[model samples]
Target: MDFYDKERLTALQAKEEAQWITFAPFVFQATRVLRNSGILTTVEAHRQGITLQELTEKIDLPAYGVRVLVEAGLGIGLLVLSEGKYKITKTTYFILHDELTKVNMDFTHDVCYNGMYFLEESIKNQKPEGLKVFGQWPTIYEALSTNLPDKAKKSWFAFDHFYSDYAYPEVLPHVYAFKPKRMLEIGGNTGKWSMASFAFDPDVNITIMDLPGYVEGAKGKLEELGYGHRISFHPGNVLDETQKFPQGFDAVWMSQFLDCFSDDEIVSILTRAKQALNPDGHIFILETFWDRQRFEASAFSLQQTSLYFTVMANGNSQMYDSKVFLECVKRAGLDVVEDKDYIGVSHTLLVCKPVK
Candidate 1:
């Protein structure tokens, strides 16, 4: 909340801006088409700009189609027309070339776009009604493990990895500072963090606990990386109250993991994690807490992501505020030992130890 600026718009300006909501979907698809149809890329390549005729010939679209799309793009400030030639704007260049933007765009379009239509119903039922767009699953994680479409899977993982992967290098030093010989990774999706730990120290052994499908996927990845011997796997649903977390870990890792569950569920998982740890063991949690964001844009993006969780991911989870998350940690009997922010793009690492 502190990250956003106060709205101080005039009445006329506020009304003008409000109209954008009406045509937002049209603009979204138009920009997507501009990117997908090679219009943005083609225009980017030509610093001097390209005419509609030349653009049509380059991308194999009809002149009428090119003109209409280019005009729409101009209205959106993604493109500009100067002296009868269409040029990519700086904003469009970033949209076309920025990795984060590309990943987020793909994730919104391919994964969360159509499903978001059921947002109202999902809110009403307190369940992910939008999940019907993909298949009947309580959560998207189930669909991810089972029958998610390939393109959606690609975008989903891309969005997931892009945010957390940047923080690995920065976070590795903190994890290694403990010099933990035995580490446990909760929610070890695809073993990216596990692999990082193994590479950080050959002698360190990692045990990844996650759903069966994720454990299997991590096993395959570790095997391919030749680090299978250094890592072990435990497959179980962490949300099940009857599920006992494996013990004997010097440190527990949950990178970008806790936000996937509801507040009560987070407390439950953290309590189980506390039980699984040695008396002196620590838990490292990496997440993009909305309240901890350094930039307004980061906070806004996470707010939108909360809606994705509401409509498509799970019914109740969200990109949490740090205050709420810390309350859960305290409720689960953990005390923060080290709180580091801005690790990589937008992540905060909270190092916790069991409260005495």
Candidate 2:
């Protein structure tokens, strides 16, 4: 209750809502079904509202199925029944048409929904037991690079890109302000940010350091874009204790990358990045810190995403609070030169210099 207004408390209502938490999983599945089964879209198509019979005929669903889903939708406030016809509500409009909602829904269903069943075990064991739903990989990153299911992989990348892609335009100016001739991008998954940097400034050369699979994928993309000569690849696992980061870069960039690691690993990686920098070099770290979010919903989304890391991704990392992340930076022999918050969506940009 530290963040809540005590005077506005409604104990009974709160208790009732708490009880309903038991039904959240069912409710989520129902919402997904309503959206995917065309019931929501069909109702939206008829702005004047549509009868149960009309919905059944139009969606090719049985009357019974239509009746149950519509009733559930009404109970969930996603639909309203007026004179025996169902109308999509304002909330339903976002659910049906919002791009963020679509990406989140698909991501939840394909990537996290089923895997979440092992959350309890994952929490108890400090391991991603839920990841067994897919295959036995230490982290989802391995599965992503190797043999992950097609739909899940698509949803995962979509979810990852949807949030970070918007921030790139804003970030490019800050990176280029340093007038870096050679920049090293760590954990450069799929090379999206590297490609963006190339587009932003054609003269700046980029070296992508990441897992071998990702390096190969990035190489293919750069080659296809005829940017093969401008970008280079260093294939290695940053988490490996003995691995040393390649040196002599003017700047290093990590976009939505460090959050994939625990605090200890973050410190280790940053320490290596510190070593890899030139005397006047800088390192840019971009992350969506839960504590730095402008909106409560953004913070809530990040908090929920921590569970995905716990149960599906790596079982150890989380969306860190800004204070905790900054402490890690300090421990790694770096000093924060600038802290810029509220960059496209919930991201915060931390510009750090090696401690001299």
Candidate 3:
């Protein structure tokens, strides 16, 4: 990525950035509280701005509590003080209203905050040590279906859907270009993509393969939505090296899924996909490779996301650099016949075919 090619910050700026890192946890919680406690929103409602006393009068918080948060907000760039009144900054607007930012923030707070403390342990063990904070599971995927708290589950789904759902509109036509009748979607959580596929294509049938719990949940939801007839399911742990992927689909799709696994696991999954390929059919992989992003902010967010894997998702997997991820794809005995980037928010679609 052109984003991180050079050291751009001055020495003083770099030292300040280091302090930002050092107090990151505090700032993050402070921001969340500001949003949740309606401090940010209250300031937003006052178009001109709200003074500490005025804001406290509008909300239930103690005046002192409101003052400190507003002062902190000033430093954090979430607020601006103009003539003794606190006003929402662009960052505050995004933190309060942006769907992407909201989803990411909620995910980090509700699902990842407590667990992330075990990051070092996870890295050392090469397992999801953070996952134990919720409950014991080999990985976060297992906990997602049954063990996660209500807020945590909601946040996780919101986060996952926010990332991939936006890409559906951009990807469907490209995928349907192959005009495949039957498709297999591994890691098709809640059948959202399948619903998108059905909406985009009149006659295509999809089978979602996932953990038994997710498959069952998706089936119920699809059935409720009157898509049961056109849908099928193959419930199994895709991570199990012994279990071969269900074979012979014209199109195989994975979106924001492969990055959940280590390089070897990703290769194994793709290798199976290669073996099961319909020769004329294609495999579509949609991921946000850190190096392929159009914005430095996006790249920075993704680089930070790698630690989420190292701590919460699975210790060995990460938000990968394109070169590193493609090396895994190459090892899987497939060739990227089509490479498309900038899909939806920030995703790369790699249309692969079995190496001939």
Candidate 4:
């Protein structure tokens, strides 16, 4: 190779090495905690804002260990110390405490931490051992609630602020805005979507259906939102033989619900949804899709979808190519009326009607 070509190759190699060196810290869970220690620091810092000695006393940690953690956090831009006291930095505040940020820190902590440790074994065996660790997929919820209650609370708060209360207002101005008098939210967790829809369109009434426990949670949120009168709950496996829904729904909204099933199950859901819909009623589906043209998508989303599908739920759910999803809709005898991409993340709003 020429001298110029050799120089360019050396520069590229240095850049690649630097990228790995930067991200290498993230591969270890300890580094991840340090990266996101704002919450821990802020609470401790507030409790001990008087001085480092007080902070050390309040947290009940060795003074030396506290100093080490604090210093490392400062280097990582997560904590700022001035006048011999520490506080959460600006980067940490938004990243750790913001209402709308999409970071799933708890999910990262629990699921990925437990699962990634077994990545090599999983790859070798061609199966996920994380499910074995948790005993079952439903147990993930229990473990999440038990182990990381505070982080889970914040995670749900983020969901409520962004996807529930705020999303409808942001989306209503678009063309084909839906204002339905009767709506159903399948697998509606905590009734965020139902509450938002009720709030946005006063005349709209919503029913949220989910597993019994989640249904109860939804009811509580609805009551808190003062939407108890207009929102109702049905608690049962909607996919089972005993599944039943009241008739005459003007629109059915399944947000992040359908992807948790196999193609056959998805078809069954469509059929049941069709049954619940009145004439001229519509069905709205919100989920991510996979498009090969997008390189960012190719890098992560497809693999994540496959892994999530394999382990998250029924071991069958996944992100489908748009064409595959459309085919499933057609097989269910639902006509695709509208499909709109939400963001570059393959999220889209699909509107469908029953084929007559």
Candidate 5:
């Protein structure tokens, strides 16, 4: 309508766009800090003393370029410069450089770095224009595991680091709602969710299923939290464990776990879970689903969700609305009595009951 109204709308839009530009550095800075720190904390660094000259020789970069890189790193507090020598920061030691640490600096550098570059494209396209945008790989995980550079793999280990942030707190209320007796956590890396539940609700017994390697680190996490008694580590493929799963469990939870597969694979998984559940057992699905109708859907929360789908799940990650999810559940012979949005920056929660 009026010029004044149009002017106000344009200003609001401009403000919103500027916020993301301002916030982009925080995202990039974290990745840069983590990546540089990982190198400094490496065992090789300790043995040979990874100075700018050594780093240049090792990586085959120019000496002048290495100096600039190291300087920027030092400026960001990721690298300590003292007595004409370089060292890693404390933040990098535990999270990035400690032996077999959860956070992977290389993965962030490769996967997340590219994802951020396309933020504006994603916002404009209303869908991720990542590698898969041009029909590249089916999923980013597959591409990375097979074709990604070694440096990128170093950062991808950070995938496990994100588990705690994505699943807990948001899913806690739902877990409590079901009041589960024998809880089975599929792909429960580090057992953080299980440990948190076991502490809050002492009556529950939590079974965490993950690959054997991830389970190795989870032991310390469980032991550190004094949850060794209540939590059990079962390492195996989740699809293969359906027959052995204890029947009649009050709840079966898959958190941010399903997007790892295609539609056919998801149906297969859900079908198996349906068979594993008792007549009245419940299943919880939590993930990001894009609402094509809402412009506000392109906000920061949505952007992050799309980026993960590109970098991790490839484009196969569906922002399924309740209707789409319900169809899948019903296809698996489950009935959805309640589906509600969880408390988070973005996404929805579906609570399903097995169909008799």
Candidate 6:
């Protein structure tokens, strides 16, 4: 975080960064086309690099189309020209091959691109103005089940799953460490975590609490998988505040769930988690706090993602700073017993109990 505190770049260098913002939309689309049109992949395959005419012949586009994109790619730092040939740069290779980069790009392109135009209005209005691009919904969460475009939905799930898929393997051990026989999973979207739970522990019973839209679908598939006896459903909106968490769970788990609501809502949710918990039960909050990240780039990515929350998500929530998030924990009258950082890709798990 300190790396961002001082003015690290010279006036000239700072101006370049500012210019990148000015042309960001064009750069984003151009780089995306280069990746999607297979221009980078083709250049990558040649190894010795390929000439402008060779790249034109290899790709399906017309000569002028290829020429324009290739030219843009060179300026965008996605390509380097040397000896009359263009080669994919390290940045381009990541854009082409890295799973994280691919997911982020797709999520941005399919879900966030058009909606981002409403950011200034969203911030001023204190609402998700961009979500109107999708449908009439207060937030994108509700729209996820019913209204999102097909490609947007696919990219959204892929983006969501990519992070959790990596985190699950590392997170499961900690959840099962207590040998909890019953667990409550809040915001159990699509039963991805439920499925993971079933595989991780054959004996533990899980009660999934979520919006009505997500819970029913998860219930049916889980039941069809013959997990009928192990998984139960509780569909209710947590923001209603009138409805409380179901009681008597040995461990209450929330994974990538809390960041969906405002800080006040988090305190409300965690307070309910405390009330629902058995005397010795611990609440496990799995979240990505930008400051907790091991690398500055990872931190930067999460920080940028907070804007999506502002303009597209609930408009009230965001990727939290650890200090701000922890203050919410204290406000809920919960004490963090174990603060574990760097869990899997970019998560920090806070183990909390009712304040003593």
Which candidate has the top score in TM-score?
6
TM-score of every candidate? 0.97, 0.97, 0.97, 0.67, 0.56, 0.98
Q: State each model's CA lDDT, in order.
A: 0.90, 0.90, 0.89, 0.63, 0.60, 0.90
Clashing pairs in 1: none
- Summarize candidate 4's per-residue lDDT along 15-66 as a digit string, tens digits: 9878766755453343355445433554444844445566566655568866
- Model 5 misplaced regions, further than 4 Å: 1-109, 114-167, 239-246, 292-315, 318-322
| TM-score of candidate 6 relative to the true fold | 0.98
- Model 6 misplaced stretches (Cα beyond 4 Å): none
lDDT of 6 at 334: 92
TM-score of 4: 0.67
Clashes of 1: 0
lDDT for position 161 in model 1: 99
Model 4 C-alpha lDDT versus the unseen true structure? 0.63
Candidate 4 weakest ten by summed lDDT:
1-10
Where does model 1 exceed 4 Å of error?
none
Query: Looking at candidate 3, what is the lDDT of residue 218?
Result: 95
